[model samples]
Target: MGVCTSQNVQEKIDNIEDDYLKLDFNRFSTYQKLENIANNIAKQQQVDTIFSSLIQRMIASGQGHILKILENIDNQKKLGFMTKLERLDFEFIDSLFHHCYKQNQIDAFQCNVIQSTNCQEQNFDLIKEHKVGIVFLCGGRSSRLSDKLLSDIGLPSKKCVIQIMMERLKKILMLSSENKEINDYPIAIVLSDQNQEKFQMYLKSQRDFGFQSINFILEKSLPVIDCKGQVVFEQETQAIMTPEGTGTIFLQINSFINKFPNMEYIHFLGLDNLVGLPLDPQMLNLISKQKADVLCKVIETNSILDDRIFYSNRQFKTMDEQDSNITENSYNSTQMLLNDLYLSVSFLNNLKYNHEKALKLNQRYHYIKRGSNIQFEKHIQDIIEVTDITILHQTEDYALLIDDPRKAVIQLSNVHKRYLKLEGTQEEDLVEITPQMSYCGEDLRKFENVSYPLII
Candidate 1:
């Protein structure tokens, strides 16, 4: 009837509902628990190092599936999904499914949250008057990409792909800036944990690129845990190993924008997104012609078999590329999978659910906080007041999914494979900083093998 304070939280923890904790399934006997753990440990061998490496890959790919799951739940298809499930064997799927249920709890903990995407700057000039600020979320430890950002792609110019993507956005934002379409808009980049110092050093000493305001910030880190709740590796007293989720950036990046208050529009792009982004980075002036609440850049799903491929891209291109390139390194790139249809369902469902969970987390925070009874009830209303988002379908080509981390590593490997076949694969011209890079928009190549075909 009232809000739960920290004291209330302890009381509730001491006394959970008998029915709530009582799982209906009768398979949960003590014998069953021991048997399952034993079996899991035995099968753990079957899992191999490959599966451990695939965790992020699988998660990235599954994000699409997670989205499908969210949509079904929102539309009251839970029972239907249960009925449709006949021959599926999901080990942690149960955990993931349960985790989605607790998203509200997570949202509760993040109550003082508000997200902004566009600029409201008044000083409109000729050059940067139209230039928009775009921050790329590229700072993860991609063990698959073999730490591709600082390292070369083994191509002609040997520039890192992050540099490739940065150049692309630079040209796009500054396209008309020459004639003063926009002022010198700075492109901010969020960096990874281990590589923060490296990025800063490069910008100062060997800063090879010309993108202005090529600023960097370290991605938040937490801790790495094993099954027994033990740390996998000793963590630094100052730096934790576990980083915040992509969703957490809605809050983390705001600190960096303190000085640049005059910024108008901001593009929150995924880091290792080498394929391409919506709103051609060169066409920033037109990308926000209308100025909607949240302009999500979505790719046209090519067909039904691209989820695995999509997940790979999402993990490597966006998260891992920004983290560590070693995610793809040298091994375990070949045995990845991509099934497009199911994956598409997953992506949408994941976003919906992630949003939902964020809301729920806010609720849980209320239940666990030290608030007065009346204050706690008021917090519930806060949860309901959060705005649902709008999606803008980007009329463009190419789709990349980051839900699956392994496939992402593999995908980066594929990018390198493509470059290796070329004689002189220079970083995109914009990366090198010349007047011509901004003018040349004719080389954008389209494809026929696109697999996930769905409306965003």
Candidate 2:
């Protein structure tokens, strides 16, 4: 045999891992499967009070099975037989019970501490003190984007949304300037296994997006494949299962941080957010200043039906074939899904994190099953269980109709709306650059671009 080169070695490594990585859809350990259901119950309880109106409806209809399990658990202790195994089950389930049912009881005693921290409006500087960062849930199968990422959405200009956002970020916040970065200012994107080639092209063309040296790390995709070896998704009938959640972006961040010692905050953006206002420097600076740990984009929608699917704290063995058969929710304190939320929950390195512990947690599964049932057992809570959760509200966070420019939502089906202005044009000159002007790079000066989303 010829000597194996680095290319050959890597290909072999990938092939071997790919074979092992695709575990059977139903092959979880018995203990692990039980753990998933138990955790989801806790997730439901955690959000119950805040979203009681919607959650009450979810439990009544969506969670008929989980609710009965919790009811059975509620009565177990009163009967008085506490074997170690039985006690472990009760105790684990009870931990979720309290996370779900009892978090509301805090309302009764009502200390200002919880109130001060939860859904509270915060300034950027003030939020920095709270150590809020970002997690760009970027990993996805870019099936919508044509063979070339830049060609997706058929823009005459070949810029994909991520590149467009980066260009905007660079001008607004001076992000790509050799040393002109906010200390600890991190911008992370979770990548899917499918689009490495497309993303690599981006790295070649627009390397200034920062995080260049170590920006693109892989997120582990959950197991869920068809007989023909395709992954399944609810959105489309024959799609492949990529990384399960944008939440996994956090895990990739934690892995990358060991090298970048000074990094602090995170600004997590969806890779495919065209309406994302990444081009506005004013917006980027404002977000940095506001000190948001996790900034969520809110578009005003007329639909009255609940767009937010309230998750139950329980594990679901995927009896249905959607994106992934399994979903994870709540866990007892002992069996916490610590890293689940550590990926999404933003905080500073002021507190050293247990990377080893996180690795152990990643071995377990997370879920989103057959009938839109989601299990959120392990979450940002295991680490940042939010002694208080603050939702920052800012009217200043609005984007104007820049050219009335709009694109169809790529990730979600049939959803159409105006997006935040990634390609920022001043009102007087709110004109699209012709092919010639865009290619020349002279048109760059005409358009005022920024990284952060805070725009005037």
Candidate 1's C-alpha runs over 4 A off are 1-127, 179-184, 208-214, 234-240, 277-287, 300-389, 394-396, 399-456
Cα RMSD (angstroms) for every candidate in the order listed: 20.0, 20.1
Compared with the true structure, what per-residue lDDT tens digits does model 1 show for residues 257-371?
A: 5545555555556544444432244324332343322334333343542212121222221211121223443222221221100001122224345766555534231211112
In model 2, which runs have C-alpha deviations exceeding 4 angstroms?
1-136, 143-149, 152-158, 175-188, 205-214, 225-240, 279-294, 302-389, 394-406, 409-456
Task: Point out the worst 10-residue segment of candidate 1 by lDDT.
Answer: 337-346
* Best candidate, lDDT: 1
Roughly what TM-score does model 2 have, to 2 decimal places?
0.42
Give lDDT per model, in order.
Answer: 0.36, 0.35
Q: What is the TM-score of each candidate against the true structure?
A: 0.43, 0.42
